[model samples]
Structure formats: C-alpha cells, structure tokens
Target: MKAAFAPTLEGWYERHRRDLPWRHTRDPYRIWLSEVILQQTRVAQGRPYYERFVEAYPTVTDLALADERELLRLWQGLGYYSRARNLHQTARYITEQLNAEFPATFDGLLSLKGIGVYTAAAVASFAFGERVPVVDGNVYRVLARVFGITEDITTTGAKKTFAKLASELIQPASDPATYNQAIMEFGAIQCTPVSPDCLLCPLQQSCNAYQTGRQQRLPVKAKKEPVRNRYFNYLVLRQNGKLVMRERTARDIWQNLYDFWLVETDEPITALTDLNLPDELAKLVQQGRLTGNPVPLTQLLSHQRIRGQFFLVDLPDTVSMPLPTGFGQYSMDEINQLPKPVLVTTYLNEWLG
Candidate 1:
C-alpha cells in the first residue's frame, strides 16, 4: 500500500510544489529559521519575515549574538513572541555550549528551546536528509482524509496513530525533504480543512474520505475554549520627551517585550478615580509631573481582551518619577529603536504622535 502511494505523491509534488524562497536552499540554518517563523503563521505572511530574519541574522552565530530587545523588535507584529525568544536562546546555546553548531540528530534538535516533535522532524529531514516524518497540521489533514480518520486529531491517541502512519508511509527511496514538503503541500493546496478540491487532488483515487464523500469530516478537530476578556489601562506618561515603558515579564504575553504602563482590571474602569493609581502615579500627579487624566484604549488578543488607558504626563523640570524595578526610562525617539509589542506601537501612535 505504501509503495503504491509514494510514487504518485512524489510525482505530483515534483510538478506542483510552490516555488518558495526556502525551497531554493538546503542550508540547515535557513531551514530551521523558516520552520520556526512558519509556526502558526501562513506562508504568504511568513515569507517576508523569513527573508527579514535571514537578512538580519545571516548566520547562526549572528542570531546567537543578537540583542534580545532588537530580536523581539524584528519579530514584532508576528504574535507568539515566545518563538522569537526561544530562537534567540537556542542560537546562543548552540554557539556558546555546542560550539556554534546546530545539533545534527532529531533528538538533538528537539532539545533546543523551541524545537518540538514536528519541528525536530522537519529540521532533521529537510536539512539533514533524514527519513523522518513531518506531521504538522497540514500533514495531519492530508493523512486523516487519505486514511478516512474521523477521531478528533487533537486527541493524544489520534496524534500517535497519525505519527505511526506517517512514519510507515514516508517514502523510503525519496529524499525526506521532498517527501515532507509534498505531504504538507498536498494538504495545504488540495486536502484543505474547508471544501477541498478533491477532483484536482493527486490522491483523489486512493483517498478514503474522498471515496466516502466525507473529506470535510475526516480530520476532525476539537472545539476551542472561549477567550477570556481582560481590561488594561496603559499610562503613557511623558517627561521631557521621555515616555515611561516597562518590560513584560514571564507572567504575561509578549514577555521580555516593552509596553506602556499597564493597569489590569477584571471589568472596564469607567472613572479615572476608580483606578487607584500606584504611589508612583500619585506622586507624579502630586509633584505636578502629570498633566492629564487617564484615557481609555482597547486592544484584543486571541484568548484575551484588553481595554487600556493612556495618561499623558508632563513632569516638572526637577522632579522624576521612580522607575519601576527592572524597567528603564527612554526618550520617545530612543523608544523607537527598542523592540516594543504591537499594542504598544498602536498606543504610541495614538498618544505620542
């Protein structure tokens, strides 16, 4: 059964694969970058980011030595900021601990900060030509449809089944890079989650779901949890052209990235007086450091909702508000050079400009 499917998929791949920049190169470092950037990101959106990362880092060593803030800044607008941080940390680990060489084996790659099972398989196969199966969302969809799988693919058992099947079906005579890409491409272009164009699919003849007329239902996914709402009041205080910003710690999203002063509440605070400003904020007002009341701004996240506030402050010539621990004060112009989360950028454009 495997023998029959391999050639057809490979032949279809050779003729129909999209011409992408990453496809043109077989460099491990480049391959790793593409895989990381593409996580939770679409091909069209990730392509420019991939090109930018390649241009900025150029090599593993360059990525290793890059400043965290600058790296985060470059990764701005691309959500899932943890990936960027992990990429930076792993690069440093490879350079400092592993002597600047990426791990050659699947296990070795998985040991890195951000590389998981799918990423490990992808990097190992695509970069090293190892015959490992790459079972990402796209591959899962294709596999489920071809095999007529109806179990929710989000389940552990389903994942294991798919992985086992993928390992068995990987083309033994073909390059792992091509095989992995072919399956991924087949899913993205033909076996899509929505109304798939089964008529044009290369696997149409052999696909079980297509034969049963249940293509849309094969790769079943579990329902998502409802997003929680959050309200944030951001204080964009300025003193002599310097804006107050702070680093998001590990406790929150956009960790290690910069943003305006954040005041979180369970529900929206309509009155400025209701927000008991911290001593620092009160001191700013008492010392005539702040000129205006708080203004509300709202931002949304995939799993969270945020309503923020901006307080434009003007400080006395001799007075300075105590900076938050672990945060540094930056002139608005200098802030432009720092890597800030997109929400911060949006706030800045509205208030600072």
Candidate 2:
C-alpha cells in the first residue's frame, strides 16, 4: 500500500493539477507569497491578489522596500492582516540580514520568524526539491481518512500521529513536491470533508474510510469555541464635506486600520442617547443634527461576531468644538485611500451612495 500510494497520487496529479501561476516557478519569494496569501483564502479568491503582489513586487527586495501602509491597503479585503505584516517583516529580514537569500533547507527556513513547519516544508520541497512533507489542513484530511485515523485532530497527540504518518508516507516518493501537492489537491477536489467522490477515487479500494463507510467520521475534530458577541457604536461625525476618522492603535482587532469614532458596549443599543459618552462628545452631539436613520452592519471573524451601528452626525461648518484625541478630519478622497476595515468600507459604499 505504501509503495503504490506515492505513484498513484503522482499519476493523478499529472492529469488533475490546476495551472496555477505559482506552479510554473521555482522562485522561493513567489512561492512564499502565494502560500501566505492562500493560507486562510481560497485559490479562486487569492489568485488575483497573488498576481497583483507579484506584479507589484517581483523580488524579495521589492517587497522588503514596500511601504507598510500601501501593503496593508493592497491586502485590505484579505482578512488576517498579520499575515501581510509578517510577510513584509520576513522579506525585510531576508533582504537586510541574509542579503536577500532565502534559506535553502527546511530546518533553516523554519528558523525565520512566522515560517512554521508547513511553510518551511513547502518551500524546501517545492523550490529546493528537498524530501520533506507538507502537512496542512488538506493533508490532515487526506491522511486521516486514507489511513483510518480516528484520533481527534485538534489534540496534540493526533498532531504528532499525523506528522509521523505524513513523514513516513513521503519517504518513497520520487518527487516530494509532486507528492505533497498531489495529496493536498486530492483532498481538496476528491476527498472533500463533505460529499467526497468515492466512486472514481483511485485509492477507493485501499481507503479504510470508504470500505468502512466512515469517510466523514474518521477525521474527528473537536468543536470550535462559541463565537463571542461584540457591539460597536460608530459615530460618523461629518462637517464641511469631510468625515472624522482615526486609526485603530489599540492592541486589538483591526489595529492600524482606519474607522470612525467607535464606542464598544456590553450590549446592543439603538439610540445614541443610550451611550454614556465623554463630556466633549456629548456636547458636540447636542450641537450637530443627526442624519438618516442609523445604519446597522455585522462582520464575523473567526472567534467573534461584531455588530456595528453607525450614527451620522452633521455638524455645522462653523462649529468650534475640538475633535477627540487621535481623531482627525479627512476628505472623502482621503478616506477612500486610507486602509479601513471591511465593515467600514461596506458602510461607506452602502450609506454614502
């Protein structure tokens, strides 16, 4: 079973692999960019971003010299901004410390910050032709079902088991890169978590999950923590055709992104009067007139659900009220250029029109 496994997947991959742009190159920089962009993103969604990034920054040095704000703006819609930030930091480190040379081995790549086992193994195998396995979510699913692994995938012991099995499985493959990509693609297209196509699978006969009719049951994983609810009240204070916005500097979600003045509440509130605002903001609100009805929007993150309500206040052009600290007025054009949260962008598009 072990000997036939690698060849079977290789043959399948030759006939089934998609023509992704990254597959045609052996450049570690491009490969790393694609992997990072596609971490929590689908191929269909991340492909354009990858193309834009490659076109913008063809080499590690180009990426290293890129403006952080411009980079974040380009990476706006693709949530998990930390990935982009880390990508930049790593690029800078490679350019400055390592003379723009990517580490050639898996262990060496792993030494870099944010370069984990999966990423290091992928780069080493795909670019350097090293015989190391890449174990991502797709690999986990493929191995768990094919080998009839019933261990809880979220547990530490199960991680070790999968890693051991993955390492052993890659030992016989003639091309470790092809074998790694083959299994991941197989899991993505054939052995999907739900409604896997077992009828035409090459490994159907040898697959324990298929024979035992437990395809969905073999890869046991613990349930995720219940999503916490958060309520955000945004005061869109506009005056003289400009909106008051501020960059989020808190060590929390949406850090470094621009948004309107925000007030978080323990519970949802419909009216602005319900808020126990600061003395200055309260006096200012008394002077300004409320615009159209409050616009409500919701954005869901991995572990939190944020429900936001926006109150547009139109202050007179001659008002002398001092703006809050960290807040400044910006024209619509400037606001459009600033990197903002998706929720804020959605509000602007829907309400401003």
Error of 1 at 289 (Å): 60
Question: 173-198, model 1: which lDDT tens digit per residue?
Answer: 46777888888888787778899988
- Report lDDT per candidate: 0.82, 0.92
lDDT for model 2: 0.92
The reply for model 1, stretches above 4 Å from the true place, is 171-173, 226-353
Clashing pairs in 1: 232-308, 233-309, 234-309, 297-308
* Candidate number of the best TM-score: 2
Residue pairs with clashing backbones, model 2: none
Off by over 4 Å in 2: 227-353
Q: What's the distance in Å from true for residue 10, model 2?
A: 0.8
lDDT of 2 by residue, 1-353 (tens): 98888899889888988999999999999999998998978899999999999999999999999999999988989999999999999999999999999999999999987789999999999999999999998888888889899999999999999999899999999889999999999988888889899999999999989999999786898779789899999999999989999999999999999998889997999998877789999899999999999999999998889999999999998888598899999999999899999999999999984
lDDT of 2 at 149: 92
> Model 1 compared with the native: what TM-score?
0.64
**Could you tell me the lDDT of residue 173 within candidate 2?**
94
Model 1 deviation from the true structure expressed as Cα RMSD, one decimal place: 17.9
